[model samples]
Target: MGKNDFLTPKAIANRIKAKGLQKLRWYCQMCQKQCRDENGFKCHCMSESHQRQMEVFGQNPNRIIDGYSEEFEQNFLELMKRSHRFSRVAATVVYNEFINDRHHVHMNSTQWATLTEFVKYLGRTGKCKVEETPKGWFITYIDRDSETLFKERQKNKRIKADLAEEEKQEREIRKQIERAEQLLPPEQNRESEVEDSAARELKLESGVKVGFALGNSAKLASKEKTEAAKLVFEEPESDRGMKRKADGGGSKSALEELMREEEKKKEKINRKDYWLCEGIVVKVMSKALAEKGYYKQKGVVRKVIEKYVGEIEMLDSKHVLRIDQQELETVIPQIGSLVRIVNGAYRGSNARLLAVDTDKFCAKVQIEKGVYDGRVLKAVEYEDICKIVQ
Candidate 1:
């Protein structure tokens, strides 16, 4: 029939069927051709071209099979990598997809006799993760890109190194703490008793009368003084009440006390006024202020940063600054100025502040008395404490 006549529906269907893979027995690997039926294959085998190709194959039959085997493996793996790189699919299912192409390498021409043999070979070579279920063998592609492998290895190494470093630091800190605890005499651990007795005798001998003479209150006042000394000094405005008390001829000691109070308030305010702002000039306020004397060694604030505590940079030097809003603004606490634990198992205890966890609304405290006496850190809820000492 003419080419145009062959375009009919029945003829088109027949042509498509013919182009599809036929029986394996009808395909010739040596000739690299496929025949539609037994009669055609037999007729082609007898032809001069087929006879010449057959003679060539006879000279090196194994060589021809080896080439076909390599080609089949390369093509099969390429398809698997491209189409199902991240999928865990059945071997039989992949084989079916592989055969959808009309000109795909036939398994009959490859060294492997079946798809199962090829899949087992892939698993043995570590090309895929293979597991057999009752239904069939499933394959998961293993990415072999060298760059990706290197990056993953490096990432794991860094993570492991960081964890090791943290563990080492924790061990060292624990050792130091244990050594310090061991060096202390048992009697010296009674922090509350020591502070009360020592402070009361000093006050009495000096003829100084405080607001409270009770041992507990005395101990608390001593701790508050220590905390105030450690905190960044911000000067407060001189109180008129203190001035009036001094004018009333309160005592020679009272005039000195009023002056000390005024000094404390001034120190507090001065520290807060140093908040960092870009391009704003700052003076060096360090230990050198005593030795080298205060100089106008001004530098602009480069950046403001917040770690566990706030920090600021002027020129190349970084300085720790007040981070707490109340402390920064000099706002007084409504709960009073003493640090006391009011709840939990350690209720009625007092401590010095080490750090505050603003997010957790808790304070890390050093226990001064009770079972946890001499303990440097105990986490207590902010609500359970009267106020942070520092």
Candidate 2:
């Protein structure tokens, strides 16, 4: 019944006027009030309640502003997560939506003077990925909660572990190389020590042989020279040693050379960042496929398209499907089973699985027949080696 009563028509009209967002300049942050115009804001500033709030703020301006800044940031990010968590939305669009809440924190009370500044702060703090295009600033939310951080930490740990294992394997290979080099001299000197010294020491004593003869000396000396010449020319032991070294050095087969060239090509292909290969058994890991009865089912890769998508024939169902490499997991075979190196240094080569380190998700494989024959890859990832379709 009263003019200023809550249920009066005048009070309803005021509420309706305040229902929508008002200009920031006419808002009184100290009293948490939004005025309709500059005159109203001026009048509110002159009021007792606003003056009291201003005095409190004046006592610790920095702390008050910082508190408001934190609250604004929290509310803004909360809205972003709830609405645009996985989208690239314009900053202005998000800001407009945020200000729709009647009781939302105002930007004038925060550290940033403008929305652009706030968005830039979000980028600098790594809260969102911000990019400026012709339309204005666009932002994508970056989830950094406990679960995301835990997953990222696990990924980094796996990477570091793999790098450490690779280094260990390289050191072991280097030691093997040193041991091999040390064993070579022994092979070249397998003959008797006296014979090796006589043969290895090819130079003659003082580069000449002294001979003295009495009567009939010329014929005897000539005969002696002929026998010495025969002995020098027929050096069977030294000749055999040289021939063995030559054979060992040239023992690389043509097949081995071809594999070496293929490895070089693979090294170049690795840069293309493609990993799919044909004739390998892989497990489908797609949640979408689960509804179609294909999730976790094994398949044989018949052909690879665009170096990423594969045409796979399901082993059990005999149905063909095209799937991205991301939805496929490599199938690890039993020890002694032949596997193809689908990634890493010896990619495209067939290797025999020697051992598996389940803890590290890596395997020790010996290259079966190639330039790296008998060479052991000590820490190939499970995904980098796969079983052939059988």
Candidate with best TM-score? 2
Off by over 4 Å in 2: 1-15, 183-390
The lowest-lDDT stretch of 10 consecutive residues in candidate 2 is 203-212
Give per-residue CA lDDT, model 2, range 287-386, as digits (tens): 6568999999999999886455688899999999877676689999999898998877666789888899999999988776644455666688887899
lDDT of each: 0.55, 0.73
TM-score of 1: 0.42
Candidate 1 segments whose C-alpha is farther than 4 A from its true place: 1-16, 170-174, 177-390
Residue-wise lDDT of candidate 1 within 309-340, one digit each (tens)?
A: 12323233444332211111111133223355
Error of 1 at 343 (Å): 44
Q: Provide the lowest-lDDT 10-residue window in model 1.
A: 323-332
lDDT winner: 2
